[model samples]
Target: MKSPLAAIPGAAILTLFLALVLALGSGFARAHEGHSHGDEAPAAPVATAPRGASSSSALELVAVARNGALTVFIDRHDTNEPVTDAVVRAEMPDGAATAEAMPDGSYRLDAHWSERPGEHEVLFEVARGGESEIFPVTLTVEAGAAPGPAGGFAAWSAGLAVAHDFRRHIAEADPLPLLIGGSGFVLGIAATLLMRGRGRGPALAVLVTATVLLAGNAALGAETPTPPGAFLAAAPAPSQDLARRMADGSVFVPKPTQRVLTVRTLVTASDMLGRTSELPGRIIADPNGSGVVQSSVGGRLSPPPSGLFPRLGSRVEKGEVLAYVTPPVQAVDMSDMRQRQGELDQQIAIVERRVERFRKLAPGGAVSLVQLDEAQAELKGLTDRRTALDNIRLQPEALTAPVSGVIAEANAVAGQMASPGVQVFQIVDPARLWVEALSFNARVGTRDATARLADGQVLRLRYMGAGLADRSQAVPIQFAVENPPSELRTGQFVTVLATTEASQQGLALPRTSVVRGSNGQSIVYEHTAPEQFQPRQVQVEPLDAARVLVVFGIGPGKRVVTQGAELLNQIR
Candidate 1:
């Protein structure tokens, strides 16, 4: 016979062998990656119920096979929100089936083959509105108990059985098997070149066949429980009780769990947020609408005629008397007052007697009428002096409200002594409050300002005035609260966001959305897919009191977690 190497067309043979080897190699790689080698130890039995999951750019789907039925769940890929009102159909081994919408937002299919143990390929057709999608998923179901080799010898025995079954299938002349065999045979003939002067065709044939069989066996043996491309661990498949960090560093959170956490998102858009500078500020009473009730001189404090002092938070009007300050007299002054009262009393007694005598004498015509009139005048003057002395000792200073507002503070008792020029009560109109912010630099056009409270409350502000005098190396800028709430109090610390003349353009996000990553880099969780949040490193600038501008690392039109971001970071 002609030398096989010389007779065999090199191009045709090489092409055929290359095609087969490539095909077989890819198949083996995929199978091995997804499954397990027969020689390796079996994977641990899943501790939870059997489940099948599939994902697409638009949706994430999972189906759990349970007692006599199957439960399916579908969520929006970008938001991880459950997709209800969707008609879902499934292709099972038996006839086709339709899933019913359950009250729990899941689809339920009555499957008779739920208990079947083997590999199953399911086709899911989901339709909602004008959009439709198909997902094909392969699920493996094993018996409740995991199987193992009987002994070490049984491992080889099982391998042999697999090989035997493969050989039997090859004998059926399937196109795939025939192609592989032909490729191996052609390659054997091609090997004859190396043995040009020797007779080793039989050995070459055996070697080629062995190599091909070895490769095929490795691919065929990979059928363990675990599959490849598992981004998340499946060992402890709890019922969405927890959010977890996936292997690829994405956050996996179920819809139900996210809802319980009240997770919310914000749509991103770019805009020109005027340049803002944050300043340490405090809540101040509006100067025009608030004032203090104080004593001009040192005196005792006493409640007004309403019988009690104006309580804290008590509403009072302008010029309302809130307290009385009884100016206490010194011991020396009291003694002088007593002496003046005694002298006036002696004079009053003499004038009273003289007036009585004058009236009697005038009636008797024994005294002149002019004399009687003069005596009466003298008695009246003496009485006036005594009355004036009594009145002077009883007068008390009244403290009044200078502005109409609520009482913000009170420091008064019925007999409390109020020192000179001391504030006894503070009246503040809560509806008319102002924020005093300290700016490191004099900022003109800082007309747009907002005050953010520590508890996430925001108050709109109108630019008032900036101080010309630098206070503590900074200028004091005042802003009036446009619509102040009742909860606001004077002297409350706050943060002020003042818009300067400059402007910037970027994505504005809630400050809470940006969090510190493990490496201390600033990171924001991006809604990359449905039920997936990927931490993206970002460069952020202060946009305003409540929002920060994302200048780099992330772009626009993506959802960023505004709420529950801290909770999401704790998932690991």
Candidate 2:
């Protein structure tokens, strides 16, 4: 009853209606899909949208316009304290620029495109509050154009368009067109089988139609471009600007403006001399060549004939009198000495007269030869006792230096009374000093040793001996300084470096070259590209005073940031 041509138009209309429904369904599926794409929300039309504060506490930001310049203010999440003196950097559309923080925790910059229309994406890097936060905001300027319709068929169409865009973006995210193509091939087989009752031409036509649909889907999928946030998940390029070697074999550092940085360089060269082993050491006096001058007798101390008390660092010769000790005599001893002197004087007078009488009577036969001999011997003894009494009042014990060296310690005062056995001065030969260090390993027949002063001066050392006694789980190793300076003193603590028979090969770098990373790992910056620097972890061992032996993680001839390393680390 109905014409076949009439049915063809209806079937075509039905096919068009199904296609529209399928397209609409796909758009709805995409609109409901809820997943953020990188740092951006897929639903956000503008690339830069103000996100909810990720801070655990409060979020504060102050936007100020100063002298036609736009200034930004950021503070602590909770405390609202001004984050002054922070290193704030902004990623603008033009490029990166450092922002100067004002006194009130506000940052200012000249916004040349403030009057421009459209939404601008601003990325703020605020390094404060002991952490770094990236604040991305989209500022839309509505200079013209009224707000459009909020809801209606037009709004729905707009929403559909957005959904379609989202679906397209997702399609470009994966390779699913190949599966669709396989499905189309299977459909084509079914169509051919179903059309077997008809002519082969019709069946082939159906198969070709299915094949074309599959091919069209595949082609559309292949033509889709990647989404905006797809590249963010890719691997990042290595940072190579930290310690790059220059064209002239030197490191170029532009950190901290290169002015306030403390950068030092060491010129390298090779020479044929005795191998040196720098050791951490301290100044000490030679135990054998030094002595403390002490007062044995308790009495008032007086300067020697020089009339000047030996001060610290004064040079003194061996056997030179540093001070005099006047022994205080007791009253009983004084009385006894006086009585003895009187008795000796009287005896001397009596002996002198007896001797005279003996000499005269000898001629007259009044005295015998034995008596004259006894009288003369008594007179000689009396005269010796009288002479000793006179010398006792004028003499005092002189404290003399036992070593020829500088005065390492001088506790003497001009009229101060010194107790018995109290140390008055310590004389040490600074030129011949020694250093004592403790080593956990037992050092036997040490081949070499060295001492490094705190002022960066190196001292040559000769192995002296190692004590058998243990001190703090370590053996004491002593070394004699080859040629010490005048500044060396006794009882000064120093580190001693004693080399064993073992040897190791590695690149030795200065201690300043190594810096601790934020993750508590030891890292060193390696110069890779011309303007890029990457961090490399390293294992270090103590080599000497100023240098450390990099036992692992770094090769020779690599440009490392020896100077201005701290400044380079400040880069975000």
Q: In every candidate, how many clashes are there?
A: 2, 11
Tens digits of lDDT, candidate 1, 470-505: 999999999999889888888999998887788888
CA displacement after TM-score superposition, residue 535 of candidate 2 (Å): 2.6
Tens digits of per-residue lDDT for model 2, 256-334: 2232354332322222222233333445677878899988878888889989998888889998999998888889988
Location of the lowest summed lDDT over 10 successive residues in candidate 1: 225-234
Q: Could you tell me how far off, in angstroms, the CA of residue 571 lies in candidate 1 after the best superposition?
A: 0.9
Please give the CA lDDT of all the candidate structures. 0.75, 0.60
Off by over 4 Å in 1: 1-104, 112-242, 335-386
Error of 2 at 414 (Å): 3.7
Q: Distance (Å) between predicted and true CA of 370, model 1?
A: 15
Candidates in order, TM-scores: namely: 0.63, 0.51
